[model samples]
Every structure is written in structure tokens, then in C-alpha cells.
Target: MASNKPALEGPVATVAPADNLPYGHGLGESGEAERSWGEWNPTEETVRPVRGRHRVAKQRGLARSSTVLGVGVIAAVGAGGIATAQDKPAVSISLPDVIADNLPDATSLPGMGSSSTAERDTASEVLAQAPLTSAGLTAADSEQGTTAGEALRARILQQAEQQQAEADATQKAATETAAAVEAASQAKKQQTAAEKEAAEAKAKAKAEAEAKAEAERLAKLAASYALPTSSYTITSTFGQAGSLWSSGQHTGLDFAAPTGTPVKAVHSGTVKSAGWSGSYGYRTVLELDDGTEIWYAHQSSMTVTAGQKVSTGDVIGRVGATGNVTGPHLHLEVHTAGGAGVDPMAWLNGKGINP
Candidate 1:
């Protein structure tokens, strides 16, 4: 018999004893016998590894926890550092707020992810280095002339207009003066012609009157020199009536004789004039020396021309009442050299003859 080997130290496990059979048998409490081998199909106990030594070293929980810690560190870095920022000048230029509510709260303006401070500084430097361009309107003006040239042109136009106006005024004044002068001349000529015509008419009238007066004086002288045809008694004398005539009294002698008696000249004189008078019709005048004139009026007939010469006692005309006389008698008047008719009877008596 071999000496029994000492059991190794390990954890104890309970098992059933097998019966003695052949090369692979185990003793049991029962007197039966069983067999087993390493080359056989495995049993439950043989297929399992040992408890403490055969455990697996798993890492699923460790991998999950490490990934979560990494995500937390990244979130802390993304928040930046709002609490550690410094105070600086904050500039604000007002514009209409469009996205004020949606805008994120400002932390650090110049963080690793922020661009506000750098962008603002760059813009200010660019503006300071810029140059302003001047306006080009004066160069683009269309007119080529300067303001002085325009002023000169305006003065020239004004002077030309003034000269033209002065010339027009002078021409108008000259025309008016000429017209007025011509009108005044025409009026003067017309007035002179009217005065000349009136003077000619007055001279012609005076000449005619003088010729008529000379002719009458000659006729009266011729008629008075003639004698009545028959002698008769004198009924009234010259200037005998107190209130019988408008000229105070009778101016001639009256003869109470027969009607239609032949009358003759009492003196030698030329037959000068014969005519009708208002108070003494069919009258004649006879003229003598020293310019005395005699009248024989109220006659029926006369046998003499204006220039016929007659002798005293010649029957020149007949006696009749052809005037304002009431009876048939000769109306006679004598005149001085001054041509005023007077009483014929007084002149006849002064001539040494009975009237």
C-alpha cells in the first residue's frame, strides 16, 4: 500500500461517494459501485471553473461613467467666466431693437468664443484711417462763364434799353412840337383872311354911298332951276305953320293952282338925279356953283336925263301930289354946301325971287 497523500488546503465541498468498480470508481456509504472517466462527457461540476480564480474582469460601468464625466467638463468650459470679468467702458448707440428678447445674456465680451471687443476695435481704427472725398458739383457745372461775365452782360443790356427808350421819347416830342406849330400857323392865316374880307366889304359900301350922294345933289339942282307952267296965288308961305309938321313947321311955299300944270326950270343947271322918296315922290335934284343944292319933288313927269342941261323957264316937269302933300304943288328944298336940305322959299327970297 502506498502511503496516503495529504490533502491540499482548499475550500471544502460536500459530495456523494461512489462504489468501487474499476479504474474510475468512488467509494460511497452504500456498498454499490460506480465508474467515471476524464475522456467522458462532462458533468455540471466539471464544466464550471473554480469560483475565486475563474471570475471575469468586466469594464461596462467604468466606460459609461468616464463618458458622462467628460461631457460635464465640456459644458463647464462652454459657460465661460461671467463672475471674473473686469469693468470697462460700455458704449451704446441706439437703434430700433429687433431681436432683444432672443439675444443671449452677455458674459465675457472677449472670451475664446466671443468676437465683440476685437470687431469693435478694428472698425474704429478703419474709420480713423479713412479720408473723406470732396464734392465735385462746381467742376460739373454746365456754364463756362464766371459770375462777373454774367454781370457785365446784364449791364450792357440795360444800357442798350435805356438808349432806345431815350431815342423813342425824343422822336415823340419832336412830332408833337411839329404838329402844334403847324396848327397855330393855320389858325393865324384863317384869322387874317377873315379880317381882310370884312375891310374890303366896308370900303365898297362907303364908295357906293358917296357916289349916290353926289348924283342926288346934281339932280336936285337941275330940278329946282325949272319954273312951274302957270302962275297962281300963293296960299301958304314957307315956315308958317306952328304945329303942322314933324320938323316944327312947313318948310316950303304952297301954290293954289290947277292940277297938271306944266312946270319949268327957274335957272340954268344940269339934270343930275331923279327918284322916289318916302314923303316926296318923283323927285329931282339940281346943283349950282358954290356947291348949293336945290330939290324939286312931288312932280307928275320929267323930260330930262341925269346929265341933261336946262335953261331957266324951261318946262322940265309937271306938278302933282306924289308925296305926303295934301294939295297939288311942287315940294322944293334947298341945301348948303354941307348937304343938309333947308327951306327952299327962304333961299328963293334971298336970291331976289318970289317963291
Candidate 2:
């Protein structure tokens, strides 16, 4: 009989078993399967070469290549997962069926020396690149805040300087105004003082001039007049009340003296009358240059005739007891040009004589 076993280098072929074989063929009498078949007997047909063996080898080789490619993809993904886990926000990751003894320490990985050193290096790299992310945004905000604070400080300083300048200007203006006002007040006071001094000087000069003119007038009047008699006593004054006279008041001034005392002319004048009258025992009337009359009554005797010119101090009559007289006296009377009697004392004072 020919054997149906396929060769190792040939294509595999399907073989049908005999339908007549018992359920427990090639077993022992107890129907147990054989534990061992020591040797196989192959015929010539079992060892024959088969076709399409190269195609089968090629397929198997392609399947093995695909499996190796899948394993490489899985290793690449695991490395990416480790990096992703480090980059994510801190959290716990549980790996199933992974024992602590089977896992490698992160520091023992390739190109990683120690855990603290790697973490420090990673933090330095993150800080260096922080400007591109949210960390960078925080840094930018802080810088802006600092800039704003500096600007505000500068503005405040500028305002303070401006206010100080304005205050200085105001103070300077006030000082200038006060100085001007004080100067003006001083000038006004000096002007007023000068004016007052001038007024006082003018008043003093006017008073001196008036006194000089009065003295010159009195000297001129004194040179033109003289008293009527010397050594005579005034017994009665003009305008005296006396019942002895014909009028109720005496109209002449009386000078009492001894009989025959010489009476002189009071001024240069013409004699208007010199003769005895009823009440006047002896009388004389003298006419002055201005037509005023001077009467010498109660005279003892008359030395001048009517119409005779007499000089001042010339003897015109003698004093004696005359008309209605109690003793010897000279009664002198003055009359104006219109025949009005005047006080002889006042008339003598006007001529610059006291009596």
C-alpha cells in the first residue's frame, strides 16, 4: 500500500480517513488511545516533491513581517504615552496587571540620570518657553503693572512741581505789591509834610510885615503933633456928668493948674477966636489945616489974636479960673469940620499921643 504523509518541503495535501475504521482504532483492547508509536513506515509516494512550496514560504514570511511592525508601533505609542503623562496636569494613572517589580524607574530610562535632575531641567526648559503660553501671560501682566506704577509716580511728581512753581509766583507777586504800596504811602507822607512846612513859613512872614508897617505909621504921626501944656493935672475928662455945667455932661477935658500957667498950641493951626465971653472969662479957638476946631476955654489971658497962625508948642493962652469955674483949669474941646464934638482923649491917641 502507498503512504499518504506529505513531505516537509512540499505543499500540504488533504487526506480522507477510511470510513470502516472503528472508533478506537490503533488502540489497545481496553479502548485507550496509544501513548507511543515508536516508528513510522513511509512508502515512496509519501516522500514525493510537491508544487507551490515557494508561495507558502513567501506568505509565512509576510505574516511574520506584519507582526514585527505591529510590535514596533506599540513600543512607539508607549513612549509617547509616557511623555504625554508627564506633560498633562498631575493625576494618578493605574496600569493593569503591572507589578512594581516589573516596571522600570523613570530615572533609569535612557538619557535620564536622576529624577530630581530631570525635573529641574524640565522646569528650566518650561520657564524658558513660558512666554508663549499662560505662564507667559502672567509675566506680561506683572510687567505692565510695574510700568503703570512708574508712570503714575512720574505724573504725580510733575504735578507737585507745577504746584510749587505756582505758589512761588503768587508769593513773589504779593511781595511786590506790598512793597509798592508801602513806597506810595511813604511818598504821600513826605509830600504832606512839605506842604505843611511851607504854609507855616508863609504865615510867619506875613505877621512880621504887618508889625513893621505899624511901627513906621506911628513914627510919622509922632513927628507932626505936640501936647498943649506941661506940668498939668487932669481934673475932669470929656463926657463927664456934672451939674455945674450948662449941659448935663461936660463936653471938654479939664486940666487943673495954677493961674497964669502958659498953655501951648496942640498943633500948627490958625486962631479962629480969642476973646472974653459971658461964661468964659477968657477963651481962644484954634482952627486946624483940615477945618477941625480946637477950643481952649477958661483961660486967664489969650496971647494970640483971631486969624493969627500959631506953631506947635507956641503959647496961646494962660490957665486960670474962668466961666463957672471953681479953680484955675484949662478946658479943652475938639470939634469936627461939621461942628460935632469928639472925645479929646481918642483924638490925641489917633495923633500918636496918650494924653
Candidate 3:
């Protein structure tokens, strides 16, 4: 230790005396360090413990600054100094009262207030109180206490439910479309069937109307004509090939009856002849207005004279065996306007009169 260094000012630390000092060095009265140690030995009894007054000099308002400086000085020392300091008793380091009172609270630091743990917990609680299912959400869910993990679980569930709802809506739309198509098809088919049925019914009604008209025409014709004679049986028809016929084939219809049966005119006409025909015996010939001729042969007597007007159903003669016949009968014949003989039965049918 050197004794030539100048003493520091203000509140210096005091050291205890060495028990065995060199011959010339000693503690001056009033506890003054008179000389520095040259060759001295220290013992437990001679060494005094450092007390409260042993402290660094106060820098007035620069207390915190002085503390910081002291810590810097300790750090600047080399590792050997640190090892020597380790051999000493452990020392307690504390901030000055005035410096600690002037420091700000830890919670007031930047990034520590708004982003505090209390705020984080409140956010987690809000999320956790939300409904777990996406099907619905209501304001009342917040009444329940909540947790962070539950909030996350609720969010996942809500997303899954939303996706499922979308899928269900899409499927429902598709099903409705299919149903609409089916209904339209069915309606179209029914309409077509109805149209076809209506067409068939119209055709049937038209055919029935035509048939009724034809029947009315036949009825009118039947009223205008009549059978030649009553109580008579058809014996032979025109075009009958037999040995008894003079022309090799019969040219008339034979109506067989008892002698003196009355014969009537078939239609309104004038008598053309009332005299005897050679093979026809006593015959009567009547000519219609259209030049068609009707002959009544094999008659016993004639009531219509030549050029006499006779109406339909007027008595004209009597059936007899006068013609070339084996029994009493009237031979009736029909001739077209050209004098061509036709079947009498067919001619009568054409007039709507069937014998």
C-alpha cells in the first residue's frame, strides 16, 4: 500500500488498525489514519467489523447514476479481481431508498399494460362462452364461465357446422329441381293423353252422325215406295236359269199367292199398258217419272188402264196363275231407264223396301 496518494473528499471509508505494526507506524489519537501500512499483521481481535457509516460518497440527486457507475466499475475488473472478490464475505447490494421511490412500476412499462395477462384472459373468456355448434348463436352464451381451449373447440365446431349446412342446402335445391322436372313430365303426358282421347271421341261422333243421316234418307225412300202385293211368298228371282223360262233365264221375281190376291203399285207412276202379254199372260206395265218401268205379270185382272195415273199403294191388279207359271203368282220386273232388266229384289232394296 502507498502512503503518497491524496485522500478522497466526502464520506470516506475507515479501516481498522493492524495488530502488529512496524516500529514507527501507529494510529494517531481521534481515530486518524496517520501513516499507511508498511509491514503489519492483522488478527481477529484487532480487526473491527465494518458498520453502517462505511459507505460510498453520496452524489445528491445522482444516486441512481452513481449506483450504475459502481456496477460498471465492478464489471470492468478482470477475472483475477473477480476471483479475489469471491474469497471475501458475500456482500448485500441494494438500491438507495430515494432511487427506488423514483422508479416506475413494472406494470406501467411499454408493451406490459394493454397486452397484459388480464386482457388476454378476458378475450379467451369471450370466445369460450360462444356456442359450440354452428347451427345457432345467441347473446346469452356469455353468462357461462369459459376457457381458452374450449373457445378453440367452439370455433372448429362452428366452421364444420357451417360447411354441413351449405351442403344440405345444395342437396335440397337439387332435389326440388328434380321434383319439378318430374311434375312437368307428368303434366305433359296427361295433356297428350287428354288430347288423344278428345280426338278419338270427335271421330266417333262424326261417324255416328253420318250413319244417322244415311238412316234418315233410307226412311224417306221407304215412305215413298211400297211392296207390290201383300200375303205373297217369293218363288223365284231374276236371272234364274230353268227350263220353264222362255228367255233361257228368268227376267223377273215371282211372288206366289192364292188367286185374286190384290196387288198394289210400287210407286207413283202412269200405266203404260194394261193388255195381255204373250208369255206374261194378262200384264200391267207402269212407267215412273224417271222412265223406269215396273211390270206386274201373271195377273188375273188389271184395274189400271193405259195412261192412267196410279199412286203408290193403289190397287192395280189381282195375283193369279195367268202367266206361264205352275201356280197362282205375280211376276214382277224392274227395268232401268235404258230398258235393261235388273234384279227386282235388289231394286226394291234400293228403295228401302225389303220383302
lDDT of each: 0.57, 0.69, 0.73
Residue 100 in candidate 3, Cα distance off native in Å: 35
For all predicted structures, in order, the TM-scores are: 0.34, 0.50, 0.55
lDDT by residue for model 3 over 110-160, one digit each (tens)? 345756777788879987875555433334434454444565578789889
The sequence of per-residue lDDT tens digits that candidate 2 reaches over residues 1-355 is 1122232421122211222124745465765434322112223443344465522221222123433323333444444522333333443323223233344554454445576687788999987754433332345556665444445566689899999999999999999999999999999898888888888888878877886776677666666677777678988888889798888888988888889889999889999999988787788999999999998988988889999999878999899887879999988899999999999988987887676
lDDT of 1: 0.57
Indicate which candidate wins on lDDT: 3
TM-score of 2: 0.50
Q: lDDT of model 2 at residue 275?
A: 93
Clashing residue pairs, candidate 3?
Answer: none
What would the C-alpha RMSD of candidate 1 be, to one decimal place? 32.4
TM-score of 1: 0.34
**Better-scoring candidate (TM-score), 1 or 2:** 2
Better of 1 and 3 by lDDT: 3
Error of 3 at 300 (Å): 1.5
Evaluate residue 29 in candidate 3 and report its C-alpha lDDT on the 0 to 100 scale.
Answer: 73
